[model samples]
Target: MATMITDECINCGACEPECPNTAIYQGGVEYDGLDGAKHAALSNDFFYIVPEKCTECVGFFDHEACAAVCPVDCCVPDPNIPESEEVLMTRARQLHPEQAFPEDYPSRFKAGAAAPAASAAPAAAAAPAAPVAAAPAGGATFVQSPLDALADTVPALESWDVPLTCFRCRGEFEVPFQFIKPGTVLHCPHCAGSFVPNTILYRDVAKRVTKFYDSFTAGLDAIRSRHQAEIERFEDQLRQSLQKLKDDVKEASADAALAGAPQKNRGFFG
Candidate 1:
């Protein structure tokens, strides 16, 4: 099993140098593979592990060096990504081809502790990703990781701001996705006039937002069956990314807050 770091990490940098494979990295920092290729940081806030380079200390130590050194015990086996001793040893051999590993190399697996069905991650889970938010350990709340990619998938998901134009003053402004709803009112900053954003453009934007939310939810589901640990971390990022889209629909739909539509401007209001 590949070890992963959870959000419980204190950024103490305890696990960075412990890996024999040199797979550990600081949050927000990019990782440089031996092949001279540069990938974006897997995490921007806490320390992270590169599953590609993680052999669970096979052929090197009887236990995971990172887990041994972590102060907070954030390092743990990734159940979502199960790996057998053979696969781990093979990875160790490939990573350090100079050294020869005996068939009975030191490993965390007692025997065939895990099954290797896919290469680290499945094709859907292995698509090239951009830097995205990395979730901490556990299914707990999400913290920010700058452009960090985790959970073996898409880099951090991006955020979108809704644009609006005041009907009365014709002044343009933007609304957050969370605040956009059927009955939400767009108040003109320039003239203090207000109107309901139920126009054709508003409907179009709402549709796109719905589509985005739908696809994103689907992507999150795709992140499953990869690695249990990675799934948690991936969920961290997914929740953190959607934090802004918090269902403020109830608040936004309370059109009574505006009392009634514009009495004069009549902009986009019914």
Candidate 2:
């Protein structure tokens, strides 16, 4: 089933950026599919997801990103638009031609369960028994929130876990998204090393994200250039047509004036 936003949504819009298919839109706003098709807003009072564009994150992630990130738990499956895993995956392929999905691509359907959005890597799923209260030393740039004061009383790395690889150590770990952002360094649970930007993981992510942006801008520029050329061509055609009409009117007026004027008996035939 395609995911749907329930009316319980608070419109915090936390789920918008998390959607891989760009299916979610703000209340009363129109949405453009990845294929450039426009879809009307499903709801004017609450954020909505376009069912046609939603693949339930079948080929992109193990779980639905939008549902996982929704603060109000409003993102839920829509029984009205039920779809099989194969069908969802086919739509995913159509939406993202640049991404490759192997036969063994991750899918919540394959797992038979929708896992947490930011869970640990499959191999380290059970390694978070030791609770950490503060952000680790080294590459970590965890922004302190008001909640930090309660870290000592609360569990560590226990919420909003985001799976990330440590670039320097090549180690994998789960960190909370609340603490990290671009340039915020994170430590690998295995190596305890700080992250650097020169690793293969970083390069791969950078290349994919860069390609997405580059392709988007290039497409827009091509459309803009084509529209500009077409507009100019039509303007030139209309200008020629207007000039011809003006010239015709002027010639007609001159002929009418000559015919209406009395002619002198200079010619014997007149």
What's the lDDT for all of these models? 0.66, 0.67
Model 1 misplaced stretches (Cα beyond 4 Å): 111-270
How does residue 221 of candidate 1 score in lDDT?
Answer: 36
TM-score: model 1 vs. ground truth: 0.41
Best by lDDT: 2
RMSD of each: 26.3, 19.7
> Over the stretch 130-161, how does candidate 2's per-residue lDDT look in tens digits?
22345669968877543334334433332545
Overall local distance difference test of candidate 2:
0.67
User: Which pairs of residues have clashing backbones in candidate 2?
Assistant: 139-185, 140-185
Poorest 10 consecutive residues of model 2 by lDDT?
119-128
Instruction: List the candidates' TM-scores in order.
Output: 0.41, 0.42
